[model samples]
Structures are given as structure tokens and as C-alpha cells.
Target chain A: MFNKIYAFIKRDVTIATSYKLSFFLRFFGMFFSILVFYFIDKLFGSTATPYLMDYGGDYFSFVLIGIAFTSFLWAGLKSFSKVIRRGQMMGTLEAMLITPTRISTIILFSSIWSFIATSVTALLYLAIGGLFFGVDLGSANILSTAIVLVLTIIAFSSFGILSASFIMIYKEGDPINWLFSSSSTLLGGVFFPIEVMPDWLQSISKILPITYSLDAMRLAILKGYAPAALTHDILPLIGFSAIVMPLAIVSFYLAVNKAKMNGSLTHY
Target chain B: MVNTVEYSIETKGLVKSYPQPRNFFEFFRGTEKKPVTALDHVDLKIKKGEFFGVLGPNGAGKTTLTKILCTLVLPSEGEVRVNGYDVVKNGGGVRTSIGLVSSDERSFYWKISGRENLVFFAVLNNHSWSRAKERAAEVLEIVGLESAADRRFETYSSGMKQKMAFAKGLLNDPQTLFLDEPTRSLDPNAAKEIRHFLSSLSKQGKTIFLTTHNLAEAEQLCKRVAVLHRGRVQGVGSKRDLGRMLTRGERLMLVVSGLEKPGISRLETLSVVDSVGVEGLGGGRVRLTLELAEGSVSTVLSEALKLGLQIHSTRTEEASLEQIFEKLTTEEV
Candidate 1:
């Protein structure tokens, strides 16, 4: 299974490399998104500057960390969309489905390549922001931030696979990508604090778990919160992962079985 | 069920169906729809080390049966077993025991070389990387693709792609092989090469189940052939056995120059002769069509000689597999 994963990852990475312009455009596209957020922060003036002052971190640094973490989280979710949509366009999804390996393993392996690609792009954005944009590394909770980043990615990817199962069964025209993009940008606390949401929306935000992910990541980067400081939200993230991961796997299996029953598993 | 000691594949009343939408709304409602039966109670047993060919026109359930036996698709009703393992209950084991090669060679990653594709599929079947590479080399050599194995499949000729598909089918050295139109798109030379290679492979211990519309290919390669038409098996047996099933068995068509008359009564009255007719021929030569008992060609010849008529040329013709297939399929629907 590890070998299968390795083979798939290597092949996909090579495939990504073959399309160099697309890779560079993806990197630049996410880079400009951060630039837009940076300008918005600048437009907010002292209102945003004071909040970072209270947190004892630079405002630019805070937004950079937020964007980086959110990028990886969204990257994890987008991995499934990439596999489903691009794979369908390339006529490879059915071929990949016919393999005897479990779908979860293949999805995981296929998505790992995208995760690595997105992470590298995120790292490049960070480096460029830190070097040329005067973005500081703010606090020294690097280890905690890394741990939270990994956990949040796993949680988001579980949901992504769940969404991908729906795509496998019924193609909704990339609605999951649209849903993830808009919701995470607006409600996931990517550019703003979740506390600013109204009570009802805040309650919904609390249930989302990505809000907590961004909060924990924000605290770790700005306030130098210990890894245990995020422990309060860990249970909820674990709960979401626990419930959604198995549901995603089961849904994937059911979808594949349906395809097989219909003899569409081999259909291009 | 096939006896474990003698058979490699068996299907008992196997049936498969796909639900057809009743109307447009049912597509979204996911309600039950009328099902289209692909295979209807197909019962077959293939012995170990036997090369069995399935001959059918398009949409005749050959692919559906192959998919069921390969464990890619489950039967809606009945049971199928491969290598003594129930296809439904022991699907993984059945998958491991058999190798399937479909017409869709494009399923493999086209950018990768043929050798890499083989190694990838090999690793999926649990072979080590070194073993995969070694076995890929062996299969490439076997399929006569060693010279071009390192080239991308996207750059290959259709025949080369087919040869590579065959190589992948043999990568795991599977005990049972299922090939669906393995030479469908090949040129004559490549098709003949694959046929000979498959024949030699079956000469080894592997059992092969193949589907093809090419009757001559089946006749040349298969020890036993099953004729499928309209989603049903019309007949299943060896070439001679299927030939005997037709009403006009052991037919001997001749164009004799020595016939004095177009409808010769002496030729009609020959012993073992079922019917004799002189079909039209130019320049006074008569084309004779003779029907005889399945094994009585020699008696018809001697009876013609006893008439004291000089025999210019005589040729005994048995029903070709092509003719038998046409007769079986073109029967009353």
C-alpha cells in the first residue's frame, strides 16, 4: 500500500511538473489573493493595527500566518476537487477507480501530491512576504502552529473526501469548490476574527470547527499560545474528523459499489 | 459450480442488470427503475488449462460475463466462482487469481512508458518493486515489445499499445486470464502474433477465456468455442461439436468438370449423400453442393466413382466456424 501511494504520488508530481505554467499560475494566483488581503488590512488602518498591538504581533505578520494556514487547509479540501474535476476532464477517474486498492488509500495517495504542491506554494508565499513585504514571524510558537496546521489539514481533508464522494455519485458542477472557497474566506476566520460574528452566526461558526482551526492558528502565531492552549478546540476537531472521516470513507465505498453495479466503474 | 479439481471458472445461472430510468424525474429521485438485463442466467464451466473462446456479435453479454468473472462487476442474480472462490464473497482472492485485459488500453497513464505502466499495475497486485520490474521485462519480452517498452505508450502504434496491454495482463503470471477482444484493433500480423502467443501461454498451466467476433481467430486458437447472440449463449462446444449441431452437417461443396448434366440423379443417389445440387457454372462445368453425414465424406466419393464417370476434381468441405456462427445467430429471433 505504501508503494502504491508512492507510485501514485510520484506520478502525479511528475504530471504536475509537466504542466509548469499551470503550477506557476496556481502559485501566483494564491500569492495575489494574499496581496489583496494585505491591502484590505492596510485599508482598515488603526482599527486593525490596535487589535494586533493588543495581541503583541505585527498586523502584516498576523494576516500572513492566517493566509498561509488557510491556504494549506483550503489546499487539503481542494485536493479532492482537483482529483474529481481534473481527473474527470483527463478521463482518469474511472481508470483509477478500477484498481483493486481501497478508494480511501488511493484518494489519500492522490491527494497527498496536491497537498504537497499546495504546501510548497504556501511556503513560497511566506518566504516572499517575509523577505519583500516586511512581514515578521511575530511569536515563537512554531511547533504548536505546525501541529495545529497538520491537524486542521486532516480535518478539512476528511470533509473534502466527503464532498468528493458526492461528486463521485452526482456531479454538482464544482459546487463544493465554490462552497469551500466562499465559506472559508467569509466564515473560516481567514482574514478576520470569529468574535466579530453576531451571536447566531457565531454559534454556527463555533460548530464549523474551521473557525476554531483559524483561531488556534492565529493565537499560536500572534499571542504565542502554547500547543495546549488549542486543546479546548482539539476535541471538537477530533469529533468532526471522527464523524466525517468514516462517513466519507463509507460514502466513497457506497458510491464505488453503485458505479460497479451500474457497470459504470469502467465507463470513461 | 465447477469442481475445484478440474475447473478454473464456473458460473451458475449468472445474471446482471442495470437499472434504466423510467423518466427524467427518476434520474434525480433515485427511484427504482426498470432494469436492463445484460446477462440472463449464463451458465458455463471452464476447465483448468483450457483455452476457451467466446464468439459473439456486439452487445451479446460477452463483456458482462468477463467482468463478472473478473470481479469487476457483480451479478444481479446467481453466482460466479473463479479458482474455487465465490466472486462475491471472495472477490479479492478472485482478483488476485485472475488477470483481465480489456480493449481499453488507454486506461493506463499515457504519458508514462509502457514498462512503467506494467510496474505500476504489478505493484498494485502486491509485487515488490524489483519483482515488478523483472516481471515487466519478462512480459515485455514475451509480447515482443522489449525494444519499445521504454517509450511512452502515447507514442506507440495501436498494435504496440495492444501488445503492452497483453503484457500487463501477463505481469502477475495469473493462473486464469480473461481477454476481451485482445486483438480487436490489431493489424493482421499483430493479431496473428498475439493469437500464437496466447496459444503458447495457454499451453502452459494458465486457463484463458477470450471474447472475439473474429470466428477465424477463435477457430484457430480455441479448443472449444461458445457462440453468444442476443444476450444468450446459442451453443457451446468444440468446433466439430458446434458444426455437428447444424442440420447440414459435413457438407462437401464441389465444382466438378465431368458432370454431364446440371442436376445429376446419379450424384443425388450416392450413398450417405443427403442432397446434391448443381449450382451454376460457366463453360459446361457444374458447381455441385453436396450434403453428407458428418463423417461419411469418403463413402460419397466412392459412390460417385462406381458410376464409371471420370472425377475431374472433388473437394470435401465442412462447415466453417463463420458459417456456423451466421447460421446460429441468424436463426429465428
Candidate 2:
């Protein structure tokens, strides 16, 4: 299993490196976006916002962490569906499906390289924030941050698999991707804290796993909260992973079975 | 030999159907469509270490059967077992025991090298990285792609891409190999090479179940062949048996220049001739096709000579596999 995963990563890395310009362009694109955010942070003049004061005193650091975490969230939430779409387009999906590996194993391993790429982007975000934007991570709790990151990835990837199931069956017009992407971006506290929303809207935000993930990450990275003190955010993320991962797996299995019964597994 | 051989693949009354759209507005009305049968009660048994062929025209369910045997598609209403394991209950087992090659050239990642693609698939078959690399090299060499192993698959010509697909199928060293039109896109030379390679693999005791529209290919590689038409197996046997099923006698074509009416009547009186067809060719020449019962070619020829019919050419022909396939598929059962 490890060897299969390693092979998938190696293949993706080789392909990624082949397009030298695009590979370097992505980093440059992310770097310039951070610089844009840095100027916006200056416009806010270091005034402590009510929503961010508890997590961090500066908008720059708060939004930087949010951007970094959301990058991971995007990778986790889109990787599986993206791979499925590519497989279908390239006509490799049936070839992969006919292998001895389980469907879940294929989905999981195919997304590993995307997650690794996002992790590097996340690190670059932190580096740019610290070196030029005056963001501080000296007080960060590395162990607790790692735990939050893992749990968050698990929860987000569950939804990714669900989106991939839709792709496998529908071939186009996946409602899950649109619904999840819009809702999470609007309500998951990626830009400002959810407290700024109306009371009823905040209730909607509370139900999203990304909300808890971003909150936990902020508490660990900015507030330096210990694992015990981070229970409020960690518990929901873990609970989401535990419940949704199985559901995603079952949904994907059923989708595959439906395709098989319809004799459309290899059809685009 | 087939009767006593162990079976590697068996399907009992297998059926598969796909839902068909009712009308253009059916999607908006949320109405269900009727189902169209792709395979109706297909029962097949392939012996271990035997090279088997399924010959059919387009939309004849050859590909559907191959997909079901490879565990990529489900049989709607029957049991399918590959290598003693049920396809549904033990798909992983079946998958591990079988390798598949289809005509689709886009199955490999276009951006990756041919070696990378093979190694990745080998690893997916549960080989360690080192072993996968070794096996990938071995199969690449076997398929004659070792020199171009490091080139991106997208850069390969269509024939080279097909060879790479063959290499990928051999990566697992599977017990049984399923090939669906494996030489469909190849030029004659490449196609012949693949045929030779597959024949060698059969000699090594690997069970090969091939589906193809090329009758000559089937005739060359398969010891036994099944003809499928309209989602049903028309006939299943060796070339001789299938030919015998279609005709109990022989067909002979005689090109001759006729002299008189009595000669035709005299030739028709021979005891061996079942039926005769005469078509006028211009310039006082005629083509006579004689359908005779078995062991009647010599008698018919002698009778024609005794009739004093000036023979331009005499050719003895038997029922070919192509003729048998055409007769069986075109005629209603």
C-alpha cells in the first residue's frame, strides 16, 4: 500500500515537474497574492478587530492563517473529484478501477500528491507572512497545530470523495462541488470570523466542518492553545471525520456499483 | 483436451442491460427509460491454458462480455466466476488473476514516460517499488518498447501506444489475459507482431480470451472460437466444427466457356452436385458454382470434363471461417 502511494506521488511529481513554467508560475502567483493581502493589511492600520482579538491582534496574521488553511481545505476538498475528472477525460479510470486495489485505496492515494503540493503552498504562505508581512509564529503550538491539520484534512477529504462519487455517476454537473465550494467559502470564516454574520447565518456556519477547522487552527497557531484547551474545535473536526469518511466510502461504492450495472464505467 | 481441462472462466446465463432514453423531454419529466439488453443469457466456459476467441461484429456484445469477465462491469442476472472466484463476491481475486488490454490508447497518462506508466500500474497491482521497476522493464522489453521506454506516452505513435498498453497488461504477469481488439489501431506489421507475441504467450500456458472483429486474427490465434450476434452466442467451437455446422458439404467454383445446352444439363445430372449456380460472364464464358456433398469434388470435376465443357479454371473451396461467420450471423435462428 505504501509503495502504491509512493508510486502515485512520484508519477504526479514527475508530471508536475515536466511543465516547468506552470510549476514555477503557481508559486509566483501565490507569492504575488500574498503581497496584495499585505497592502490590504496596511490599510487596516493594525487596529484589533473584535472578532480576531481573541485569536490574534492583527488582521494580517489572522487572514494569512485563514488563507493558508483554506488552501489546504481547497486541496483536500477538490483533489479526489479532480483526479476522477482527469481519469475520465484521459480514459484511465477504467484501467485504474480494474486493478486489484480497492476503490477507496485508489481515491486516497491519488489525492496524496495534491495534498502534498498544497502543504508546500501553505508553508510558503507562512514564510512570506513572517519574513515580509510581520506575522509572528514564534508562539505557535506545533504539536497541536499538526493534530488540527490532520483532522481537518480527513474531514475535508470525506467531502472530496463524496464529490468524486457524483462525478463517477453523473460525468458532469456535480452539484456537490458547487454547493460545498460556495457554502464553505461564504460561511467557513475564511476571511472574517463568522461572528460578523447574522445570528441565523452563524448557525449555518456552525454546522460546516471547515468552520471548526479554521477556528482550531487559529487557536493553535496564534493563541498557542494546548490540545486540552483546544477541545471545543478539535472535537467537532474529529467527529466530522469519523462520521463522514464512512459515508463517503459507502457513497462512492454505491456510485461505482451503479456505473457497473449500467455498463457505463468506462464511458465518459 | 478442452473437456478435461480446468476452467479458468465460467459464466452461467449471464445477462446485462443498459437503460435507454425514452424521449428528449424525459429528463425534464423525470421519467425512467426502458432497458436495452447488451448480453442476454450468455453462457461461456473457457479452459485454462487455452487460447479462446470471441468473434463478432460491432455492437454484438463482445466488449460487454470482456468487461464483465474483467470485473469492470456487472452481469445483471447471472453468476460469473473467474479463476474459481465469483466476480461480484471476490472481484479483487478476479482482478489480481487477470490482466486486460483494450484498444483505447488514452488509458495511460500522456504526460508520463511509458516506463513510469507501466511501473505505476505494476505498483497498483501490489508489487514493491523495486520489483515493479524490474517487472516494468521486463514487460517493456518483451513488447519491444525498451528503447522508447523513457519517452512520454503522448509522443508515441498510435502503434507504439498500443504496444505500451500490451506491456502494461503483462506487468502483473497475470494468469489470464483479456484483450479486446488489441490490434485494432495497429498497422499490419505491428498487428502481426502482436499476434506472434500473443501466440507465444499462449504457448507459455497462459489463458488468453480474445475478442476481435478480425476473423483471420481469430482463425490464426484461437484454437476454439465463439460467434456472437445480437447479444447471443450463435455458435461456439473450433474453426472446423463451426464450418461443419454451417455446411455439411463443399463449394467449388468453376470458370469455363460453354459450348451447348446439353452440356449444362449433363453436368447437372452428376450424383455429387447438390445445387449449381450459373452466371454468364461475357464472351461465351460462364461461372458455375457447385455445392456438393462431402467427398464429391473429384466426381463433379470428372463429370464436367466428360461433358466437354472447356474449362478455363477450376478451384476447390471449402467453407471458410469468414463464410461461416457471415452465414451464422446473417441468418435468423
Candidate 3:
């Protein structure tokens, strides 16, 4: 099964490497997203700058981490769904589905492929965003931040798989995928603190795993907090992982089994 | 020609169904409709090293049965065994044991080279990278695509791509090969080359199960053939056995010199001839065709002699597989 996973990842990487224009677009897109969001923050009367100063960090640094994490994680999850959906559209879905390996393994392999791509973009984001914005690049808890990022990826990607199940079942009508990609970015505190929202929306956003991921990321990068300082956020992220990962995986399993039972596993 | 080896693939009462749309709404909501029988009680046993051909019109359940045996699709009802393992219970083993070649050229990544596609599938089949590369090279050589191996698959012509697909199927050196219309859209020369390659594969002790709509190709390559229609096996046996099933025997065609169109009745008056058909007449000659009952040629000749018809030339022709197929598929018996 490791061999299968390895082959699956290798296949995606080979195909990804072949698309030079798309690779460049991914890099440019990551850069453009940060620039766009920074200007948007400026237009808000630099309301966020004084907030970051009060927290003893540059406002640009605060939002840079946010931009990096959200874009990177979003790209990782989207990569799996986009590539797999492309395979389905091209009628190779049956080929992938019929393989003896578990469907989760295939999804995992593809998500990891995208995760690597996202990580490269994140590194470039740090380099260019730091140089241009003159933000003090925080590294007080870099290792712990990296670990949380990894766990957050695994957690969020599992939910992405669940979203994929929704896609498989509904076929084509509305753009549920767009709803997934953008909704999470907007609601999960990628650009601002959910505390700034109304109480009801804040309560709803707190339940989202990305809310905790963003909180922990801000604490680690801007607040000079160690892993121990992240206990309030870390515990919930772990809880979200425990609850959502299995739910997502089981949902995917159920989706595939349903497809098989209905003879729709290969249906376009 | 089949070798003297044993049977490798055997199916008993294999049946499969796909959901069929009964109405427009059901058509829009596909897979919610009534089940359409794709394979209805198909029983086939293929001997090892045999070049078996499955001939059928479209919607004849050829691909359905192949997909079932390869474990790509589940059989709604039936028992199938490939190399002694049940397809449903031991699907992983079955998948690893058999190779499949579908007619679709888009199955592989178009952006990757032929070698990359082979290695990817080989690795997925649990081979090491080195072993996968080695196997890819070997099969590429076998399919005569060594020169084009480095080029991306999208650049390949249909024939070259087809050959690469064949090479992919052989990556595992599978004991049984399921080829679904393997040479469907190729030029005649390219198709002939593929047929020759298939013959070589059969000689290597590979059990080949092929489906084709080309009757002449089947006649040239298959030792035993099965005809499918309307989700059922219409006929299944050696060509000789199928030919013998036809009641009409020993069709004879005569190109007589100095004969005219009016000779149709005189030819029909022959004692043993069941029916005489005048195809055409040209240059003071007639093209006469006769369908005779078994062992009736002698009586037909005597009757023709008695009629005092000039017999410039005569010859007896056995029924071709095409004729036998046409008779069986169209007629009741």
C-alpha cells in the first residue's frame, strides 16, 4: 500500500511538473493574494496595524502569517479535489477507483502532493512578503508552528475528502466546491479575528478547525508564545482533529461504498 | 491456433446489469432506473495459450464481461475465476494476475511520456522503480515503440498510442490478457501488425481474451469464438462447430464460360442443389452461386449435365466464418 501511495504521489508530481505555466501561476497567485489582502487591510484605515502594535508585533507580520497559512492550506486541499475531479472529468476516475488500494490512500497521496506545492509557496511568501513589507519575521515558536501547520493540514484535508464525497454524490449542479474553498477562507479568520464578528458568528467560527489553526499561528508568530502558551488553542485544534478527521474519513468510505452499491462509482 | 495447454479462464453463469433509464427523468437521474441486463448467464471457458475471440455488435456485453473478469466491475450475479482465484473474493490477486487493455487512448496521462505511464502503473502494481523501469523498457521493446518511449504520449499518433497501451497491459507479464477492441480504430496495416503481435503473445503462453467486431480479424486469429448479442451469448464454439451448426452446407460458386443470364432456371433444376443464385453475367459468361445440402453436389452435377447446359468451369466453396456468423446471428438456428 505504501508502494501504491508512493506511485500515486509520483504520478501527480510528474504531471504537475509538466505544466510550467500552471506552476508559475501558483507562485504568482500566492504573491498576488498577499498584496491584495495587504491593500485591503490598508483601506480599512490600518485598523489592524494598531491592534498588532498593541500585541507587540508588526501588523503586516500578523496578517502575513494569516495570508501564508490560509493560502497554503487552501491550495493543499484544493489540489487534491481539483486533480481528482479532473481525472473524473477525463474518465480516468474509474481507473483510479478500480485500483485495489483504499480510496483514502489515493486522497492522502494527492493531498500530500499539493501540500508540498503549498509549502514551497509558503516559503516564497515568507521571503518576499518579509522583504517588501518590512515586517519583523517572527520565529519564536517556528518548530511548534510548523508542527501545528502539519496537523492542521491533515485535519483540514480529511474534511476536504468529505467535501469530495458531497461532490461525488451531487454530480453537477451548483458550485459546492467554490463554496468550500472561499467559505472556509472567509469564515475561518484567515484575514481577521472572528472576535471582530457578531457574537453568534464568532461562536460558529470557533467551531471551525481553521479558526484554531489561525489563532495558534498568530500566537506562535506574533505573540512570542511557546507551544505551552498555545494550550487554549491547541486543545481545541486537537479536539477538532479527533472529531472531524474520522468523520471525514468515514464519510468518504461511506460515499465510495454507496457509489459501489449504486453502481455509480464510475459515473461522471 | 491454440496450444496444447490447459484452461486458464472459466466463467459459469456470469451475469451483470447496469441501471437503465425508463423515462426522461430517470435518464437525467442516471443509476436510479431499473437494472439493464448487460451479461445474461454467459458461460465461457478459455484454454491457456489460446487466442480466443469474442465477436459482437455494440451493446453485446463484451466490455461488461471483460470488466467483471478483470475486477473493474462487479458482476451482479455469477461465478468467475481467473487463474483459479474468484474475481470478487480475491480481486487484488486477480488484478495483479491479469492485464487489461481497453480501447480508450485517454486512459494514460497525456502530458507524461510513454515510459512514465508504464512505470507509474507498474509501481502501482507493487514493483520497485528499477523493476518498473526494466519492465517498461522490455514491454516497450515488445510493442516496437522503443524509439518513441521518451516522447510525451500526447504527441503519439493513434497507432503508436495504441501500441503503448498494449505495452502497458503487458507490464506485469500477466497470465491472462483481456483486450477489448484492441485494434478498433487503427489503419489496416497497423491493425495487422497488432494482430501479429497478439499471435506472438499467445505463443508465449498468455491466455488472450479479445473482443472485436471485425469478423475477418477473428477468423484470422481466434481458435475458438463466441458471438454475443442482446446481452447473451448467441453462439460459442470452434469455427468448425459453428459452421457445422448451419443446416445449409457447401456453398458452391461457378464461373461458367459461354453462359448467359437465362441459365438460372437450368442451374436450379440440378437435383442436389437446394438454391441457385445468379450473381451477374458479363462477356458471354454467367456468375452462378449455389447452396447445396450435405453431399448433394454429385446429384446437382448430374442434373446440370442432363439439362445440356454448357459447363465452362465449376468449383465448390466452403462457407466462410462471415457467412456462418451472418446465418447464426440472423436466423433462429
Every model's DockQ, to 2 decimals?
A: 0.43, 0.79, 0.36
Task: Tell me the spans in candidate 3 whose CA falls farther than 4 Å from its real position.
Answer: A1-10, A42-46, A49-58, A91-104, A173-179, A257-267, B1-6, B21-32, B248-316, B328-333
Best candidate, TM-score: 2
TM-score of 1: 0.88
Which scores higher on DockQ, 1 or 3? 1
Total backbone clashes of model 2? 0
What digit string (tens of lDDT, one per residue) describes model 1 on residues A138-245?
655888778877788878987787677666656554565667667778887666665667877777677676777877776776678888877886778888889888
Candidate 2: Cα lDDT at A189: 90
- B142-213, model 3: which lDDT tens digit per residue? 998999999999999999988987887887888888888888899999999999999998889898898888
* Model 3 RMSD vs true structure: 4.5
The residue pairs that clash in candidate 3, if any, are none
Q: lDDT at B41 for candidate 3?
A: 94
TM-score, predicted candidate 2 vs. hidden true structure: 0.92
- Which runs of model 2 end up more than 4 angstroms from their true locations? A45-48, B1-5, B21-24, B254-274, B280-287, B295-315
Of the two candidates 1 and 2, the one with more favorable DockQ, higher being better, is: 2
Candidate No. with top lDDT: 2
Span of ten consecutive residues with least summed lDDT in model 3 chain A = A168-177
Q: TM-scores across all candidates?
A: 0.88, 0.92, 0.85
In the order shown, what is each candidate's alpha-carbon RMSD? 3.5, 2.9, 4.5
